[model samples]
Target: MQIRLAGGRIAAEVHGSGEPLLLFHSLLADRSSFDRITGQLAESFQVIVPDLPGFGASEAVTGGLEPIADRMAEAVRDLKGSHRPIVLGNGFGAFVALQMVIRHPGLVSRLVLADCGACFSEQGREAFRTMAAVSSAKGLSALSETAMRRLFAPDFQAAHPELMQERLAAFLRTDPAVFRAACEALAGLDLRPDLTKVDVPVLVLVGEQDEATPPAMSRELAAGLPDARLMILPGCAHVPQLQAPEHFLEATLTFLTNDDTGRDSERVQAVA
Candidate 1:
């Protein structure tokens, strides 16, 4: 489905038949990033997965995170009506989700952020800038290796060569200009101070072996948010949903259902 927003048309995949749950993809991925978990999530909630503008089938529009969030928030408001949906964002999408909360309070019922932090370290920011430069000058192919390293853990890549190839193919299809723009935008992001404004129940999930955002980044994000908890998936990398889908789903379901009494669960566990 394509929804026309103020900025441009947003390409989305809608499934299931309950309350809305928006799934936002990472920088290197499209809506398909959540394909593994969508069925399970859709069983209990309506899953709305959209390609952020400039990726997938969405119209490519150049702007920073604020504009992107505004457009996405408008589209969500139109689709879900008065129903406040739970939002789940991964990597770059997580950054946009935080912006949505900050820019439009009460727009979301709950928040789930995966593999993203409040702000990147100086070194990380520099890395993003380098990615942008490389993509702009030589295209996505030039940065494929770097992207893979940031996206998946070494062990997972070594074990799942076919999966890695699949993702690489998808990465090659991304618009280099748009990819560079996103990287530049991310390099300037710092959402630490605004995290306090998020009042909804928030769940922060990160892979223990995640290299791009790291576990420390998630710890900072959880600590900064007013009502938030952090869960670390063992033996996983930047994309835990892909690296450890079962564990990811269990922790997510538990958090969304509010079955656990404790506000924080540092580790992912199977839900009985």
Candidate 2:
């Protein structure tokens, strides 16, 4: 259903009870990306997953990533109310969540930053530029395969053909304008200096085989934060939660519930 935010209405799914857990999906993917795990998550917390600013039923907004982040932050304020929620962001959504935390420090209690970094390498920025240009000129259908490759590893895609088809459908549903704007914003984004503002604990999780935001990027993000832990899911790619739901849950469940005391143990696996 549509949830009203300070800026606009957004499509969202809410489940279970306990503390709130907000999920932000990747640019190429929609909220449905979390379907495989939301049920189990709902068993422990009130999991709220939205289509982001422009990906699904939510209306699109202009003026770059700041507005996108602002809108999402508004969603946080509206849903969270008196409770400081736990936020989990994947890929582009991670960037949005980071900006949200930077702009509003006390809005959330903790963050599960997955497959995102403070800034991209030049080569990474160039990749987004090339994608935006191609998708703009030739359209998303032309970039479908490339987009899927960025989401899942090639072997994984080959192994899960039906799931790949479903994901492709989700990607094609994205608005061209929003896609280009997001790509451009991500290419120019730099959130390093603001990382210090996030006083809440963070779990910087990444897929070992992820090329989109590489493990190195997660390392940089973990190093920049005030209080954080880094965890790497073995043999997974960008959307590990979809590809390896077990590992994703194992790595994040404790942190999401705020029961993570084993900072040095491999309770949810280690980063090295």
Candidate 3:
């Protein structure tokens, strides 16, 4: 389905019916990235996956990243109406999700951030800049196997050749200009200063072998949030949802269902 946002058209696919879960995919990926997990998640929650502007079926963002975030938040609000939705983001999509929480707090009830940074550290900014430059210069074809290798564990990529091919195709299809602009916006974003304001429950999931954002950075993101849980998926890389679907599904289901009970389990206790 398509919806008009602040400045562009949004193409989104929604599945199941229950509490709404808006999923945002990382750079170069669209709603399709969540195809495998969506059926599982949709069984419990209404999953709304949108092809972010300039990346998927959505229209280009004429204003830039911040506007893109705002537009996304608005689209969610407009699409779901009064329903309070759980927001989940992957990689660069996680960054936008955080931005949504920061700029449109009322729109997001809880956050599920996987394989992404919180944008509070210099290293994170620098890393984003590097990705943008590389993508712009050589398009997705130029992405070194070294980068792909880091994004997924050797075992997972080897086992899922078709999945890897689909991901690579998405990367190559991304427009260089849009990719560069998004990266520049990410480079300037810093959400750390406002972390305390985010009092909602947060679940942070990181792949053990994820070099793009790293586990330590995810730890920092969890640390800054009010009530947050961090889960490390074993033998996985940046895209755990794709790399470690079983673990990802288990952790995400538990979090969404509020079934976690132990120290690391789901806890609804508010920070404030």
Candidate 4:
């Protein structure tokens, strides 16, 4: 259900009842991308999965990720209950979450960021630019193969034909304009200078084989942020949760439930 209190710019489904846990999906995927793990997470959290702006039932926003983050903040405010939300973002959603906490200090209690970083290297930036140009000219279908490659390792794709097909369908459903805009936003984005402003506990996870954002980017993201922990999911690519759901859950749950470490848990440079 859309948050009636928030005027419904963001389309979301509510699950269970407890501390709010917002799940933000990747650019190559939609809200349904999280379907595999939402139920188990719901057992412990009131999981609210939203279709980020320009995806699914959600309304599109302008000005790239900034406004999208702003819109997401509104969703947080509307859905927040007794506790501040613990946000879990994947891929592009991770980028939006980074900006949201940066732009709005003390908003979420903590963050679980997967497959994202503060900035992309030249080669990475070029990938986005190339994708944007191709998708804008020939439409999203033209880049289906490339998008799948980024999301999963070639071996994984070859092994999981049905899942690959499903992911491809989801990728094609992305609006061409929105897809292009996000690609452009990510290509030029550099949040390294402002990383200090995040000021919240963040658990950063990247796939060992991620080609889109790469592990190096995740390393930089963890290093730049004030308090963060990094984990590399074995045998996974861009979307670690999708590729290795058990590993993803174990890391995320441990981080979310273990608060005894205090400031140390948030240390960005630590890797396990």
> In the order shown, what is each candidate's alpha-carbon RMSD?
2.3, 2.3, 4.2, 2.1
lDDT of 1 by residue, 1-272 (tens): 44444344887877786888999889887777788999999899988888888887787766788888887887678674556988999999998998989889988889999988988999999999999988877888998898888889887899999989988888888888888888888899999989888868888888888889998999899888877888888888788888788989998898888755345535434222
Q: Candidates ranked by lDDT, best first?
A: 4, 2, 1, 3
* Per-residue accuracy of model 4 over 1-272 as CA lDDT, tens digit each: 54532467888888888899999999999988888888889899998999899888889999988999999999899875779999999999999999999999978999999999999999989999999999878888899899999999999999999999999999999999999999999999999999989877888889989998888898888877778888888788998778878778888888889975243433443232
Give me the overall lDDT of model 4.
0.87
Superior candidate under TM-score, 1 versus 2: 2
All candidates' lDDT scores?
Answer: 0.84, 0.87, 0.76, 0.87
Off by over 4 Å in 2: 258-268
Task: Rank by TM-score, highest first.
Answer: 4, 2, 1, 3
lDDT of 3: 0.76
Worst 10 residues of 1 by lDDT: 263-272
Number of the candidate with higher lDDT, 2 or 4? 4
- Tens digits of per-residue lDDT, candidate 2, 1-272, equal 33555455677878887788989999989999999899999999888998888877788889998888888888888874567988999999999999999988899988999999999999999999999999989999999988989999999999999999999999999999999999999999999989889878889899988999998898888888887888888888899889989888987886766665334422235533
Q: Which runs of model 3 end up more than 4 angstroms from their true locations?
A: 1-8, 62-64, 80-82, 120-124, 144-147, 259-272
- Candidate 4 off by > 4 Å: 1-5, 261-272
- Among the numbered candidates, top lDDT falls to 4
Model 4: residue 255 alpha-carbon error in angstroms: 0.5
Error of 1 at 204 (Å): 0.3
TM-score of 4: 0.95
Q: Report the candidate with higher lDDT, 2 versus 3.
A: 2
Candidate 1 off by > 4 Å: 1-8, 259-272
